[model samples]
Target: MIIMRKHHFLLSCIIAITAFTDGSQQHRNTEDVSDYFEQIRHDPSSLSAFLTAMPKGADLHHHFSGAIFGETYWNVLTESNGWMQPYTIEVDTAGALHKAPWIHFATLSRESRFDSLKQAFLRKASIKDYDPSAGPSDQHFFSTFSRFGAVARYDMKTGMQEFKQRALAENVSYIETMLGAPDTAIRLAAGPAWEKSITGASLSDSTTVFNTLDQVYAALLKAGIGNTAKKFCHHQDLLHQQAAIDDSVFMLRYQLHGNRNEQPLTVYRKLLIAFQAASMDSLIVGVNLVSPEDGVISMRDYSLHMLMFAHLHRHFPHIRYSLHAGELAAGMVRPELLRYHISQAVLIAGAQRIGHGVDIAHEAASIPLLEVMRERKVAVEINLSSNEFILHVKNDQHPILFYHSHKVPIVISTDDAGVLRTDLTEQYILLATRYPSIHYNDIKAIVRNSIVYSFLQPDLKERKLGQLDSAFIKFENQVMFH
Candidate 1:
C-alpha cells in the first residue's frame, strides 16, 4: 500500500511537469509572432512585404461591386465589346480639367477622340480622384457606385472572380461579400398586398410570412437568377480545379443586400429575396443592409426595417444578417439617429454582426450596450480606411478602441477595397500603426473572431480554424525562424 501510494504521487508530478512544459512552449511560439511584428515596424518595405503574405482568415464585410477598380471595370466592359463614348465629368464648382483616366495608351487608337476623354471617364467612374472640395466626401464615395453601375451590373461572374482572385492572391482564405442575383426583382403588383399582410406581425407568424414572400419571388427565379448564382459557384469550382487549387484553400460565401434608400416595401422585397436566395443555395450565407445609412428614407424607416429583419430572421432562422449601423457622424445625420442604431441592430433586429459601428459611444446606453455586445459575441466589422474617408471618424473618434477595451469581438475588414484603395493587410497596418497600445495578441484574437463569427456552418468553421492554425505555424516559421 505504501509503495503504490508513492508511485501515484510520482505519476501526478510527472503529469504536472509535462503540462507546464507544453504550455511554456506554446507561449514561446506566440511570443515569436509578437516579436516579428514589432521588428518589422521600423522597416517600411519589409513590413509591407511581410503583411502582404500574412494569412488573413477572412474579409467579412467586403462588397463585390466595390471590390473591382474603375479601370478593371472599364477593361471588362471593353472585353465584352460594350460601347462607351468619351464623356467628361465636370464637378459643378471646378471648371478645371485634369489628366486622362487611361494609365496607358496601348488599347485605344491614338487618333480616336475617346482617348482624350479617357482620364475624365476614369475619374467619373471611381473614388480614385474624389476631391472633397467639390462635395461631401460620403456623397462622392457613394456616387462612385452608380457611375460604374451600368457596366458592373451586367456581370456577376466577373465580379465574383474579381473578389475571389484578389482574396486568394492576398493569402485570405475566406470571403463573405455583399452580392445578389441580378435577375431577382420585386413584382410591383404584389408589393402593396404583401406589405399589408406582414405589417405589425410577430415572429410567431414567420412561417406564413416566409411562405408568402417565397411565392411572391418565385415567379422571377425561373427567368435565371437562381441559375445565375448556381453557374457562378459552378464556374468557380471549375476554375479552382483548373488552377489546381484545392477548394478548401479558397472559400467564398455571399451576403445579399437590402438597399435602405428605397421605399419600405422595396427594402422588404429585397430582404425577402435575399433570404430566399440564401435558403436556395448554400453559398449564399448571409444578408446585409447597404447604401448610405444616413439617407433620409434610411433614417426615417430604420426601426421599421429592424422589425422587418426581426420578423424575417425568425422564419429563416439559419440565415445570418449584419447591419450597417452607426455608419453616421455628427453632421451626416440628426443627433437622435445615432443614439440607438447599434443597440437596436443587436437587441431588436438580432444582427449577428455590425458593420462600421463608428458611433457606438453615442448610443443611448453606451456602456450597457457594449456589455451586451461582449456577452452576445456579436462582432463589429471594422473598416478603418473607409470610415475615415467617409465619416471623418478615426483615431480615438473611432469606436474600435472602445470595442477592444470592452472586450467586444471585432474583425478588421476591407469595406470596399477598390473604392477605398485599401486591402485587409493595409487595414491591419493601419490598426497597428495608429494604436500603439494594440498588441499582437489582440490582432490574433480578432483574426480568430472573424472566422468564428462568420456565417460558415459550425462544423466547417471548426475545420477551417484547424487549417488556420496550420497556416499560422507555416507563416510564423517562414518569417520568424529565417
Candidate 2:
C-alpha cells in the first residue's frame, strides 16, 4: 500500500554526508557516533555549550508569555508609564477577603520598585520556586501566566525577538510558539455584540454551528479585528525579518492561543478570532487551547469547547490546531476526568498534536488511545522540565517510555523556557542524563521529530527539514572521530 522513497531521503543524506566525507569514513559505524556523543555529554559544560549548538529542529509547545525572562517582563512592565504593584489576597477571622498590597520602594516609580517586589514576583511567576522536597503544584505553575500577564500583554514584538534570539542561542532552527494578541481591548470590545447575538441552542445543528461560526468570523472582520489580526501577522513577519538578519537559519510561527476556561460563547468567539486570524495570516499556521486544564470552568466545558473547535474546523478547515490535553497527574483531578481528554482531543477536537500529555498512563484503556495516536501520527509535545516542575512526573514514572515503546511519536519542547528557567538544549540534556535507554541516535530522532510533527505546511516543513538535515551532518562530523 505504501511506496518507500529510498532515493529521496537518501539523496539528501548523501549530500549531507558527502559534504563531511573524505572519500573514506563514509560508513563510520554507529558506535563511533555514539562514542562521540557520549564524549560530548561527559563534559559538565556540554549541556549548555555543545548541546546548545546542536541542531534543534523546533519548539512546538512554547508559550510567548512564558518564553520571556523575568528581567524582560520587568523591563516591559516598567516601560509602562504606571507601576503594576504586586498584591496578596488574605482572609480575616470573619472570613472576609482582604487585599494586601505592598509598596516597599518608598514612593519610587515603577522602574525602581523592582528592587523590592519584582524579584519576589519573578519567582512567583516561574519555576524558580519549584523544589521537589517542598512542592511544585499545578496551581503554582499555571499561576505564572496571570502573575506576568501585565508585562507579557504589551511585550509581544520585543518578546518575540527575544525568544528568537534565545532559540538561536540554543541552535534551534524553528519554533511554533503560542502568541496572544498584544491587547485584547479591541477583541473584547467586539465580543459583547457577538455574545448577545449568538446562542448555544442556535449552534445545536452541525450546519448551524458552522454557519454561526462564519457569522462570528465575518462580524469580527467588520468590527476591525481583521485589521488587528493583519497587523499582528505583519508584526510577526517583521520579527522574523529582524531575527533572520542575525541568522537566516532560524524560523518562527505564531499559534493563536485561546483561553479555554471562558464561557462557551466567549471561548467560541476567541476561537473564531483565532481561526480567522490563522486563515488570514501566513505567519500564523495554527490555533491552540490554553489555560489550566484542571480548572473548574475548563473541566466543566471541556466537551463543549471541543465541539466548538470541531465546528470551527469545518468552517476554517485550512487552520491546524492542537489541544493542551492530559496535563494532569494521578491525584490532580477526579479519575473520571482523566480518561477522556486525550481521546477526545484526537477523535473529537481534531488535534494534530497534544501538549504535555502527562496523564496518558492514567487514562482508561490508554493502550488503545496510544494506538490511535500512533496510527494517526499524532505527536505528543513533551516538556520534561515543565512536567517535573508542574506535575512532578519524571524518571521511571513518566509515560515517555510507554509512548516510545508503542512507537508513538514524541517531540521534546520548551513549554516555557523563561518561566521554567531552561531552554530546549537543557531539555535535551535532561533526556540524555535521565533516560538511560535514550541514546544519541534517539536524541537526533527527537530533533527530527519536531519538524516531522510540526503543523507547518509541506513546503515550509521541507525547507526546515532540509536545513535540519544539513545541520545534523555538520554537527555529527564535528563530534565524531576524524
Candidate 3:
C-alpha cells in the first residue's frame, strides 16, 4: 500500500510540472506576439498586414464616391463610349475654390481657350493645390466633386464596382457604402431641362410651387419606357464580378439626397422615394440629406428637412438612418444653426449613427444626446482626415475623445478617402496618434462595434459576426502562439 501511494504521488507531480512548463511557453508566445504587433504599429508600411490580420469587422460610414480612387474615376471617364465635355477649370484662389468671386468664369480664363479651360477645370475638380492653413478647407475639398459629377453620371455601374474593389483593397471585410440612388440620378438628369420655367418664384411661393415640381420630376424619373432601367441593370450586371459579389460581405445603402438647391417639396418627394425604397427593399438601407453644408439651399431646408424626416419615420419605423449632422462648425455654418442640426437629427430623424459628429460639442442640447448615444450604443463614425481638413477638428479639441469618455461606441471611418487624399490605415493611425489614450484593443473593440452598429439584416450579421470571431481566433492563435 505504501509503495502504491508513492508511485501515485510521483505521477501527480509529473502532470503538474508538465502543465506549468506548457503555460510558461504559452506566456512567452503571447509576449512575442505583443512585441510583434507593437513593432508593426510603429512602422507605417507594416500596418496593412497587421490590420488585415486584425478582425476589422466593418466600415460603417464609407462614402461611395470618396471610397473610389480618382484614377478609377479618370479611367471610367476616358473609357466611356459616349462622353463629351468642352469645359476646364483654373484656380481662382490658391487654396479656396470659392474665392476671387469678383472675377466671373469668362474673366478667369485668358490663355488659349483650351489651355485656359483645362487649367480652370483641373483646379475646380481635382485637389490641385490644397493648403492646410486655408479658411474653410472643405470648400475646396467638397467642391471638387461638382467638377467631375457630369463625367461620373455618364455610367453608374462602373463606379459602384470600382468602389467595391477599392474597399476590398483596404482590407475591409464588410462595408455599408453611402450612394446617391437612381431616383436622384433621374432628377439630376432632368434638372437643367426646365431652368427658365421656375427662375423667378419667391422662396415662400417656391415651397408651394414644388408640389407641381414633384409631379413633373416623378414623371421625368419614370419616363423612357423602362429602357433606362434595363440599361442600368445590364451595366451593373456586366460590371459586377460574380465572385466578388458572392465572397464579399459588401452591402450598399443608397443615401438619396434632397438637393438643397431644389425646393422643399422637391426635397420631400426625393426623401419620400428614398424612404419608400428603404421600406421596400433590402438593398436600400437608409435616406440621408446631403449637399454642401454652406450651400444656400441646404441651409434653407435644414429645419424643414428634419421635419420631413420626422413625418417619414412615423410611416417606416424599421428603416435605419445615419445622418451627416454636426459636420459643420463655426466657419462652415452659422453658430446659431449648429445647436439644432445635431439635435434635430437625433430627436427628429432618430438617426442610428451620426457621421462626422465633429460639432457636437458646439451644440447646446448635445449633452443629453451624447448620454443617450452611449446608453443606446448608437455609434459615431469618426473620419479623422475629413474632420481635420473640413472643420479643423483634431487633436484634443475633437469631440470623439469626449464621446469616448461618455462611452459612445465609435467606429473609425474614411469619409471621403480618395477625395481627402487619405486611406483608412492613415485615418486609424491618425486617430491613434491624436487620441493616445485608446489602445490596440480599443481599436479592435471599435471594429467590432462597427459590425454591431451596421444596418444589415440581423441573421446574416450574426452569422458573419460568428465567422469573423472564428477567423480572428484562428489568426490570433497562428500569429501569437505558432
Candidate 4:
C-alpha cells in the first residue's frame, strides 16, 4: 500500500510540471503576439498600402501643369485634332531622347511624328534614379519641365484622368491644384485681346475673372469628369445666379500667378487683382510668382513678392497660400538670399505652407523660425526625390529627420511625380527604408498631416479623415488575424 501511494504522488508531480510548462509557453507566445501586432500596425509591409489605408486629408500644394505625366502628353499630343506640334527626337550626350526648340516646335503638324514618337518619348523621358549618392541641380532640374511642357500643353481630359490615377495611388483624397486660366492663355495667345480686356477696370473685377474660370471649368466638367471620383462635395447651379460658377468634382482649389521677374509694380498690381478676383469668385485661394528661379528679376523682386502677399493678406484674409520658397541651396542663390527666402515666406508672405523648404538650416535664425512653424502648425511639403534629385541633399544632410524630431509638421509628397518618374507611394517607401527607426506610427502621423494640412473645405476634410481611420482599423484587424 505504501508503494502504491508513492507511485500516485509521482504521477501528481508530473501533471503539475506539465501544466506549468504549458502556462509558461502560452505567456511567451502572448508577448510575441503583442510585439508582432505593434510592428504590423506601426510599420506595415507596403508604404503604398499604408498610404492607401491612411486617412489622407488634403493635397494643398499641387501644380496642375506639373501634375500631368509624359505618357498622357504623348497620347494627347498624338490624338488631338489641330493641337499637334513637331516633336524633335534628339539624343542628348547621355543617350536619352529629348525634344528641343520648344517655341518653334509648338507649331508643327500633329500627324508628323505620331507613330514613332510614343515609344521614343517613353525611352527618352527622364525617371528618378533612386540613388542617394547623386542628385540634380535647381536650374538644371526645373529646366527639364520646359522640355516636356510642349507635350503636356494639349488637352484636359488625358491630364485629369492621369491626375486622378496618381492622386488615388498617393492616397490623396482631395487636391488643390493651380492651373492657367483661359483668360491667361488667351492673353498670351492674343496679346491685343488681353490689352483690350484689361483696359476696362483691370482683371480684379470678380465678374471678369469668374467669366474666364467659368469657361475653363465648364470645359473640364463637360469632358465627363464629374461625380465620378466621388460626389461633388459642394456645387452651386449657376443658370439662376448672376455670374455662373461650376466647381470641379473633387475638392479642387485654384491659384493664379504673375511673373516674379516682371516689374515690381506690375507684379503687385497683378497679384492684388488676382487675389481680389479669387476672393470674389471663391475659386482661387492664392497667388504665386512662377518663373525661372535663378533669373535676375526673380532674385531682385523676391522680397517685393513677399511684401505683396503681406499687404494683400489683410484685405483678403480668406485666401490661402503655400508659396514656393527656399527651393534653392548654397550655390543656386546668393548667400544673402538664402537666409530670408523661407523666413519671408513664413513672416512676410504669411504662407500657410512652404514648398521645398530645403535650406531651412542655411536660413538665418532658423531654430526660432522652425519653432514658429511648429507653434503655428505650418508644414513643409517634403519631396524626398525632388530634394535628392534637385538639391542633392541626402542622408544626414537632409533636414526632414530634424523636422520630425523637433515635432514640426511635415508631409511627404511627389513634388513633380511625373517629371521625376515617381509617386507618393515611392516617397513613403524611400522614407521607410531610409529611416527605419521611425516606425509605422510616426509615418502614419505624417500621412495624417498631409490631409490635415491640405487646402480642402473644413467639413469635407473631416469626413475624409473619418474614412481614413476606418481604413487604418481594417488594415490593423487583418494583420492581427494573420
Could you tell me the lDDT of residue 204 within candidate 3? Answer: 44
Work out candidate 3's RMSD over C-alphas: 9.2
Prediction RMSDs, each to the true structure = 6.5, 7.5, 9.2, 13.3
> Please, what is the TM-score per model?
0.82, 0.81, 0.73, 0.69
lDDT of 1 by residue, 1-482 (tens): 99999999999999999999977876787798788888777677877787788778999999877887766776665555444434434211112223454223233434465444555656665666777788888888897776666555565566667777887888788888887433344355566777677554444555666666565455445444455445555654454445443386877777888888777566776677677767766767888989888787787677777877876786688888899999988877778778988998999899999999998988999999999999999999999999999999888888888999999999999998888877899998888888867877887778878899999888888988988877776777677666
Q: Write candidate 3's Cα lDDT for 1-482 as tens digits.
A: 99999999999999999989977876675466556766666666666666655556677777666666555555554344222244334222222234332333344333255354454454455454665565347777877776566555554566677656655676566677765634434444445544334443333444444554555545644654234334434444444444244364555444544555567546655666666666655655666767665568667666656656666676678888888888786766667777777777777667888888888887886779888888877789998888777777789878888898889989988877667766676777776556667766677678778778888789867976776666565556688754
Most TM-score-accurate candidate = 1
Sum up the clashes in candidate 2: 0
TM-score for candidate 4, residues paired by index: 0.69
Question: Any idea how many clashes model 1 has?
Answer: 3
Backbone clashes in each candidate structure, one number apiece? 3, 0, 6, 6
Using lDDT as the measure, name the better of candidate 2 and candidate 3: 2
Model 2 misplacement above 4 A: 1-31, 38-49, 78-116, 130-136, 181-247
What local lDDT does model 3 show for residue 251?
50
Instruction: Residues 1-482, candidate 4: write the lDDT tens digits.
Output: 99999999999999999989877865564455445534554465644464454445456556666776666665554444223223545312212234444322234434465456545555334443333333444544564565455455444445655766666655566666665322221122333343244232221343543343344334433543333211111221121132221223234556666666665445544565556556555545566666665578777657656766766686678877777788777877778778888888898779898888888888889999999999998889888887887777777788888778778899877777676777666777778667756666677678778768876568766876777665555555554455
Q: Rank candidates by TM-score, best first.
A: 1, 2, 3, 4
Best by lDDT: 1
Q: What is the model-wide C-alpha lDDT for candidate 1? A: 0.76
Clashing residue pairs in candidate 1 are 100-119, 101-118, 101-119
